[model samples]
Target: MSEILRLDAVSRHFSGLKALSGVTLRIDKGEVLGLIGPNGAGKTTLVNAVSGVTPASSGKITFMGRDITGIKTYQAARLGLARTFQIVQPFAEFTALDNVAAAALFSQPGESLKSAREEARAHLAFVGLEAQAGQSAATLTLAMRKRLELAKALAMKPKLLFLDEVNAGLNSAEVERATQLIHQLAASGITIVMIEHLMKVVLNVCTRIAVLHNGVLIADGPPREIIKNPAVVDAYLGHQYAQRNAAHG
Candidate 1:
């Protein structure tokens, strides 16, 4: 597969604390890569760095063969890099359609409100939120809000999408729905990097897995191999997961 993004020894520091340390990675086009880790393992920081929410202190980030280490968040969005936040924060007062329309307007230059709303409708429909389009965002259920976040990201027309804990607070059925959406997105040929805690969801949707622990990448491989990796098991997956996987295997 062709490379879509590359991070060469990337590091990010906040007040002398290394949130990310020499994290080098690469993403291929149309890949569904799961970024898994325990809490505070720098998974989100790495996504922030690549998406330009937080600029890296050192090393390079290349997207589509061009360096974007210093690109701003808006610039990154315009360049077809979009991400959904772990905390789904939509404009409470805005209608669901308007919330997505705002994203479309912001990411694409010269997009009129009318044109943006038209496009937002399509994106909302894609995420199964068409019926709630006219409803106030604050009135939506958590599951609907999560789908709204996805609709908003889709409005940006991203080539590479970062999904940060998209299934964190979901129930089993909701997670299944979200997983199906992710499968659809991947099947549509978008390169995806998902930071997820649920091993089942990660294993189900991701083609490969990358594990982080205390700001370092300890494992990278196919799910079957990663689940058996000693360092990954120690750092995040734990013995129980391994045993359960073995039982299931």
Candidate 2:
């Protein structure tokens, strides 16, 4: 596969804390890579840095062979890099269609509101939110809101997508639905990097896994291998998880 993104010795510091430390990684086109780590492991921080929400203190980030280390969030969106927040934040007053339309309008230069709304309808439908398009965003349930966030991201027309804990706070059925959407996205040939806690979802949707610990990457490999890796098991996946996985295998 061709390389789609590369991070070379990327580090981000906040005051005296190192949120990311010399994190070098590469993402291939059409890959579904699960980024797994315990709480405070800097997974979201890494995504923020790459998506230009938070600029890296030092090092480089290249997306589609273009340097994007210090680009603003809108610039990243325009460059086909889009991400969903771990905490879903929609404009409460805006209708679902308008919410997505805003994403389409701002991300792509020269896009008009009329065309954006038309495009938003398709994206909302893609995420199974077409019926709720006219409803106020605050009226949607958590599951619907999550799908709306995905619709908004899709409206940006991202080439590389970052899904940050998209399945958080979801029930089994909801998680399955989200997983199916991810599978479809991956099948559509979008390169995805997802930060997910549910091992089942990660294993089901991701082609490869990368584990972070204390602001550093400790393991990067296939799901089966990552589950058995000592460093990963120690840092995040515990002994119980390993034994359970072994039994299931």
Candidate 3:
């Protein structure tokens, strides 16, 4: 597995406050990398910088072996990088199929509306939303909306997909479904970088986990090792779990 995405000494600041501090990480081809942290820990900021939404203060981002530092958000998509937002951004009035079609158009050149629609249908089916193809985006439930977000991102034919908290606010079953979809994506050779809060989902789906704290990388390893890292326990996994572990010892 070759490295598909790499960030070197990346940092982001807002109004002189650091959002990400010298964060460095890599996502290899055909791997699912989980990014986990408490709120304000710079998980999303690091993602935004990589996806070109926010410019890094100082660093380099390489995608598919090309330097994509400071690349435009839209242009990144053209280069086989696509992302789903933490907040689902559907064209409210469009049908689910239309929403996906819009993304299919963003793929490679020589895509027609009809051709995009056909590809969009496949994406919708992949997300288990084929039945909702004709339904208005605003009419879908929250879980379905998140699925739609995944479908739309997939429609772009991305090689590297950044999923931003797609499991947030879903029930257990919904999370399981999302996990399965992600598993399918990885099986099909789409490298995934997921930002998720749910530890169980991360453990189940991620090949490797990266922990961020105070705008920096604190830990990165296999799921079980990351969970056991003392720094991770101190930084993000509150005292309750740690205290319980100590008591049992």
* Backbone collision tally, model 1: 0
lDDT of 2 by residue, 1-249 (tens): 999999999999999999899999999999999999999999999999998889999999999999998989999999999999999999999999999999998899799999999999999999999999999999999999999999999999999999999999999999999999999999998899999999989989999999999999998999989999999989999999899988988
Regions more than 4 Å wrong, model 1: none
Candidate 3 per-residue lDDT, tens place, 58-164, comes to: 98999988999999888888988899999997999999999999987866556889989999998899899999999999999999999999999998889999999
Per-model TM-score versus the true fold? 0.99, 0.99, 0.95
Model 2 segments more than 4 A misplaced: none
Candidate 3: where is the Cα deviation over 4 Å?
Answer: 242-249
Worst 10 residues of 1 by lDDT: 212-221
- lDDT of candidates 1 onward, in order: 0.95, 0.95, 0.90
Backbone clash count, each prediction separately: 0, 0, 0
